[model samples]
Target: MARLALSAIVMMMAFIAFTEGLRGVGPKKCCFKFNDKPVLENKVVSYSRTSQRCSNPAILLNTVAGRQMCVRPSASWVKDLVTYLETKNVAGANSNL
Candidate 1:
């Protein structure tokens, strides 16, 4: 349970880093790295909380935890990103999700 909760937090932070870009400082050219052999099987990329930050959307969709996290973006920042992304796709950026 603790692991899951921690994972969730990590995922959310990662989402914010990419989707919102760290306090409007702008995107940081990020990417998600994972080891899926246990469940994702796509561990080519490498990124841990301690690793450098990134802002690439491809990173989020490439893994299980990442995919879930990408579904969420900071509420305050989504409007701008969505506008930039040019889509009304706030399907997962909500707190309810």
Candidate 2:
């Protein structure tokens, strides 16, 4: 019985450590407001309405030196910007045809 108890304790400790390690491994949660620093329109690479893996919707943008930036989706300006980009992309594709 004492050996069994020791084995159980070890398993529980291992489970806790595993869970803690996982908690630190995923993407960092982020929230943004409209009044924050303006993201350049020309720098936007693409946008995703809702990232299934992310906690909230975000706009993907290319920042200085090719880094990516995730911006909040709730902003009206962000919506307009996405629409504009989509239309621009379509138009560009058509012109190439």
Tell me, by lDDT, which candidate is best.
Answer: 2
CA-lDDT, candidates in order: 0.41, 0.69
Please give, for residues 1-97, the per-residue lDDT of candidate 2 as tens digits.
Answer: 9999999999999999999999977666443532346666776766554345666656665544676666666677777777878998899999998
Give the Cα-based TM-score of candidate 2 against the true structure: 0.53
lDDT of 1 at 72: 26
Tens-digit per-residue lDDT, 1-97, candidate 1 = 9999999999999998787655676453444543222223342122222213454333232343444223223333433433433332343355347
Badly placed stretches (over 4 Å) of model 1 are 22-97
Residue pairs that clash (backbone atoms under 3 angstroms), model 2? none
Q: Any idea how many clashes model 1 has? A: 7
